[model samples]
Target: MIQRLNVNTEVLSTYIRNSNTPIEYLRQKLPNIDKFLKGELEPTFNQVYALSKLINIPTGLLLLKEPISASSLNVDFRTFNSELLSDISSELKDTIIEMQEKQEFLKEIVENECPFVGIFTFDDDYSDVILKAKELLGNEITRKRFDNYRKILGQLGIFIFLNGKYKDNTHRPLNLNEFRGFVLSDKKAPIIFINQLDSKTGQFFTLIHEFVHLLYGDSDLFDGEDSKKRSKTEAIINSITAEILVPKELISDMFDNQIDIRTSLDSLSRKFEVSKFVILRRLYDLSMLSRKDFMSLQNELEAEFKLIENIKKNSGGGNYHNNLLFRMDSNFFNHVNNAVQQNKITYTDAFGIVGVGYKGYKILSRGG
Candidate 1:
């Protein structure tokens, strides 16, 4: 049987007319819609179905009284994958404590500063940037203290999120394991994510180092070793990250002309409360020690670490980093606590999400 059908092409016509885009641009990219206009495509519902899949748009919105601009809304799809963390075993899970700390640090940033829109508009002069932050924060935040690290991040719009547990075998990506921090970017909100499992001193340095990248509006993911390499831009930021942590002026006065790298390394390490290896790395950046000397010292530190590991194995409480997972999940606990306090979630539910029992929850809920 052959039948003739009359269609009301009004819905499609009205949408196309109201769109701000030019007819040609719409016609070329949106061929499905163009087909509908040409009367070549059958069943107008097919137009609606195809547009939704192609543009990640909703079908219902397209049928509205006023045609919507699909470009107005933006979604960020940045993903962080670290080959460095692939070998980490499941037993080394991240904890709630660390997660909370990371999140709290980020939440403070979101609340205090505007979202970092992009890296292209970042400031390059490191000294000026830190000086500005220092001036604004005053004594409440200083270069030497760990708290100052948190304050600096708060000033940036990066909100840190820590997930997984300490003994649960969770770790950062293998490639990024050396890197302490990373940044997220989209057309709208830009965020920085710092891996909290690194020691406080390491984390502090990474925070500042990554801040340097953000200032320059760099979009590449970086790790620790890359930061050590000297480039005109990186050199400036490295100096600032190091000097802000341990003022260069203070280092000059402390070392004098002794030229004893080991003694100076110890002195600076003790003074700044940073690891000897970190102090040495900074000193190398300052050109205080030759490359050969720095390598020698690094080897010594590695030996010492190996010896310590051996001792810990024999003495019990093996070399595994205790409280690692707990430290990572510090933020998760805060969320769970809020949920519990608001009566929106039960302790059982909280424990379930965290993969802990009520007993563990009781200890965690007390707050770090």
Candidate 2:
């Protein structure tokens, strides 16, 4: 005689919607899940727990009388191309939840010392915002590359995260069409999450774009091109971001130095240390390049990108520890390690948040 509990089907339904978990996946992960979901049959405790894990929700939450909706830490940023996002993938939603969980834990321990956060608004002139942020960043954005900017952001007490999969679950890779980056602004533990699956250049541009969201003290989910369409707030932040990456006067000056449009683009790319995509975007935005030509140039670049990806794919994935370290910001990782040392959080807690075991965590602690 097996005992089972009548879990709240309504709660389960709400969670499934929030998670975007596929019905087929649930069916495959749990036999007779349909009956459990339909309340036709009570779920065994084990079944309920398994279902909870499958949906990436806490097992106990299934018993709640009403479901508390997750914020997803983002406003519903709509665009003309909203049709493209018929649904946010479960994997991406899960990734956001994981990041928010880490932030929730870290906020209690982190210092709310960064002064640049929540300092700007869309009403302010974009140029003024760029001027102020650059004054503080002071050449970090100029001489700095991606990794350098990452460290600087960490120093500013922002949580930086980049991963192609959900919670290191390789089975669930993020979709770039859904979002290129996300940011949730906070006085303490502000978060910047980039989709590592995007082209290295794409990620770079997205980084600054999300930083703008952080500065405005707002939350955003940014998808390149799609996000640039019609949102007024997005437009202001993007305008600021363009200036931060490649100042109008500077790009204009640099543009005059080259001969052939194609040849000069490469030269400008090297000069600015930004991606050709970014250079083209800046040029197009400034009315320096035509959209048709820009699209043509971008297609050529995309073809080159595909070739590079295949070559890299043929090679093995890089060292696990290095990848893990790359995915988690040193700024955030150090706090976790320090918390362990201060006995504020157990190694177990650190390990869980960092998605590492004892050996991997030790390597991270040693600054690997």
Candidate 3:
């Protein structure tokens, strides 16, 4: 006899309502999904487990006594109190759940606390924070600015994952508008995720912002665009991030009001190794650019950024192993491998933690 489970059809329906996954694709994975959704058939244990893994939600959610929500209100967009954070696209939720599960596992075996975590309070002077950031930089290496930052951050115990899509699922691309990046804060294994879908320099700027969030030892979701919902913490983090990216004193010394605004934006971006928008925003914050002029230039820059991103997206990627480093945290990768070697975690367990199978893991180990 097949053991059937009483799955909440209402909750299942709500979860799949706005899912980016096509209904036909889901049917391929769980052929009885239509019946399950309609309450025509209670799914079996195997069916519930298959649905959980496919949708990136916990299996226990399917067994809930009642739907988590009283109604579908705000289930589509709002962030919820649950750690599962189920309302987002499976891609985003999957990535979050994967990184976090690995972090939790690492905490058991890793003993060292990162000195930089919780180094400063939110109210602390940003100028002082910049000095601390510079201290972390030590001797500045002249290179691609963000690449240098990514290297040092990983070495310093902050794991960096930069990607425009979810894992290697090319079909499921990330949306920067919904979220630019997020930080998962841990003293020993903090994680920084950048949605590379943003403009090139915009990604770097977000890296800095998420780094700041890590310093506070707090997990935060960042939306880089201007919004009515931005909090005091976000405002402070942005201010500090902007100042750190393009220091006021440095800009004041180099900026020439007589230079054409367009020319100045280009020059300053190159000089500071930041995006044109960052340069413009810093200038605007300094009252160096008129509100009317800033608004006009901002729209122009946004369009240019989008066009460049589209062109790059069309012409991107071939090296798979090389990409494993950017998409998965290298330091964490080694630690997971080490655990596998000691029999602390099985190869299967390692695969689940890193979100890859045997062949992919082999490729990643070559590049880890």
Candidate 4:
């Protein structure tokens, strides 16, 4: 059965502008859309069809008596080095695909439950609190320990999934920091596509930072460039994430705020169980040190804190995702298991539907 609705052209125009459509993408499909929007022309079937394609929505839904704003939108882009990923092993590709599918699933759930909306809701003070907490954990924690923390957090509703994987092409050198994470606007789960080759520490920090983004209800990509031009919300989230990882009271108790940069860095690093670089970042967030101090400390730790090499060959098995999915309590896994066992979906089709590869299917089946 098919259904249709007639959406007002004026309301639709408002929706388009508010949503931040790049002019080029808009112009490519509906050249006359501009004219129709400018004037008060009633939208035609063609216009509705064009909009349906652009928004990835059903055509008839456009005719609803009231216009509804999408809480989230999916945007896909290849890594800066998409061509390079071709030579990467198939297992890596499979992992990335699985991560992406799971992220999309989580996003669908979050866009609806967003509690806070707007800029002022996130402030610098809120962020400092998170940083202070992280500091208290101290430097004794290993990457494995942090992973366990993340798993526990996931149980509490922090969703992280892969966004994309990166690799070097024949022309370009491989970028070890290949994966990029994104926070969706509605406080749903954030996305994290890891470099199958990077170290556990960098991945852990990214998971924590991206989780902070989710808490703040944002949807933006972190380019990790320019410290000064950050949006207020971003600044707050960064602050909060730092605090959550290495809290303020703990740092204050361990070292004087006015201590020498290197001494403080080492002490804070040891105390928080985080890298010295992260500790330095936390200090900057606290406003206890000048920008120059932060930069100097950053440079000092650059060599030691440089991202580790990626695993190109057999990275063997490390499935944070598998562990997550196989844990019977996960909603997606539970739903998938029930559907398959009840014969709602054939085993072959179930594998295709969930986008899990053969090995994943076998593992999931065993878990069930």
Candidate 5:
């Protein structure tokens, strides 16, 4: 005789409604799903397990007396429309839950080494924050290439993750048009997530922007675009990021009365290792470019960048292993691997922490 398991009908129904999974799809899998939801029938263990797996919810939650409230992190979703906010919020909730779990596990075995994460408050001067970031990251960061920014941030105990798709569905990539980066406010295990779909220069700016958020102990999502519509905090952070990346003194020193706009932009872009858009923004800020010229140049640069992106997409993806390792920053990966090696966590547990299967773990272990 098959034993029927009593589960929280409300919780099950809520999970299905919130998830991307359609009710019809679940009905196809469980023919009696309608009855189960209506409280006419209790779900068997297998049915509960399948439902849990499908919705990416834990089976233990299904047995609770009531459905857990949909609590979200304190994130300022700047410029995100109401319709898309729910989807992105759900995605962010899942990511943060996974990160928090990993952080908790690592905290048990590792000491709190990062002391700088929560040192600053929103009341602190933005200049002071910039100076602190420069001191911690070092002057070499200014001279080095853009990718080195991630390495420097990691050294300062910031965990960075890059992913283009949501955890529940890899086929649907994150919309970079909506948001480019995310930050979580935590003294220990502060995290920054960059959408890999964004351009390299855009990602670089986002890294700094999110780092600023971490310093102020604020969690937020940003589109990384300059706009008059931005909030005061967003405006301040954007200005600070630009100043840190391209100092006003540097711009003044580089400006030549004889140089053309194109020549100046090229020189500044190469020197700063930033996109033309950033260089143009700085130029406009310094009044080196007229409002008319800035708008025209920005439109031209955006079109050119879009063409390059399209070409890259058509060329197929680069190395999978490299991308995987990059998405899971080496610092975080090493910690997981060390935990596995030290027997603090089994390989199976490590796989779950790193979000990979046994086979994928094997490849990652080999420096993939």
Candidate 6:
């Protein structure tokens, strides 16, 4: 006779509700789910294991007497609309946990040598914070800065990852509108993950925004919303990011004379290596653009950005290996490779840490 195990009905219900799986699907999988829920029948170990796999919950949790309550993530999701919180899928949560585990491993081995991870304090003024960040970055925002931003972050002992799709289901891509970036604050090993599906300029801004969260030692998610209507903490960080990217004095110098708004915006965007949205915000902030003109240009720029994004999506096929290296950060790759070379970790373990297979690892090893 097969031994039956008592499963917590409340925990099972809560897991199913929180997960992407449907109730009907669960009912189909466990034909006697109703009986189980009613406490009329106990679940077999196999049934419990299958339910765990389906809902992405640990089987051990189901065996508990009481329902397990999930701990809050300590992340503030900045959004105009609260509904976007629902988009935080199980895959995303699992990805974050996995990244944290990897970060812990790195911290254990390399924390002593890395001193820049928790250099900033929340008590520091935004101006001072920005200056220190730039000093650590080794340069101000420029046309080529994006290429080296990740390297700078890595040098500061911040691990950054870029992923467009859910780790478990590649078919379901992460929605950029829901969250552009998130930072997990740890003194020894802070981590930031950016949604690569966002526009390049948007990604740059998100990096800075998330970095600001790390500076304050706050774990949070930044949904690319209007900077004007930000929360108090977000407003402070947004102002800092703007000033760091486009200094008021520098922008004032650029707009000394009257010129075509469109032409000047294009020129300034290229010069500052930021989105037109950011450039326009600076201009509006400096009283350079009239409110009416600012609103008009903002709408125009957003439409154009969407069109360009759609065009790029249509023109597919990019180098997967190089892109992986970029998402993983070159400095991160170097650290992992160094660890492997020093026999601290095997190549297989390195591959797992880097989120690549043997062939992909070979390509990354070749610096492709």
Model 4, 286: alpha-carbon shift in Å? 4.2
User: lDDT tens string, model 5, 1-368?
Assistant: 44565667887888888787988888888899999999999876546656767888755456445665446223354322111243344555455456554554444444566777767876788789888878876665355555677878887778888887654256656776667777766666677888778877777788887887777776653344223323666777778888888888888888885888888888888788777888998989988878999999888887998899888778766776787777876777788888678765567567766777776677677874
Per-candidate Cα RMSD to the true structure, in Å, reads 13.8, 9.1, 9.3, 11.0, 8.7, 9.4
Better of 2 and 6 by TM-score: 2
Model 3 — TM-score against the truth? 0.73
lDDT of 4 by residue, 1-368 (tens): 11222346656665566557765787788776676656544554445546655865444334433454332221221232121121333333334334444444344334344332222234445644454334433334454555566565555455444322322122332345333334433344444344423345454565666566555454443233233434444545555556666767777567676667788888766655566767777767667778987777677677554432233343554464564353222445545566568764466544543555677666655663
lDDT tens digits, residue span 64-111, model 6: 455544444323443322223534555555555556545545554554
Global lDDT of each candidate: 0.48, 0.71, 0.71, 0.49, 0.70, 0.70
lDDT of 3 by residue, 218-306 (tens): 67532332243345566677787787778788899999999898999998899778888789989999999999999999999879977
Q: What lDDT would candidate 5 get against the real structure?
A: 0.70
TM value for model 4: 0.53
- Clashes counted in candidate 2 amount to 0
Residue 259 lDDT in candidate 6: 86
Given candidate 4, what's the lDDT at residue 44?
49
| Cα deviation of 309, candidate 5, in Å | 3.0
- State TM-scores per candidate: 0.51, 0.73, 0.73, 0.53, 0.74, 0.72
**Candidate 2 vs. truth: CA RMSD?**
9.1
Clash tally, candidates in order: 48, 0, 0, 33, 0, 0
Q: Cα deviation of 129 in candidate 5 (Å)? A: 1.2
In model 6, which runs have C-alpha deviations exceeding 4 angstroms? 1-87, 113-124, 139-142, 167-169, 221-230, 338-348
Angstrom error of the Cα, residue 168, model 1: value is 4.3
Cα lDDT for residue 78, candidate 2: 22
Q: Give the lowest summed-lDDT range of ten residues in model 6.
A: 74-83
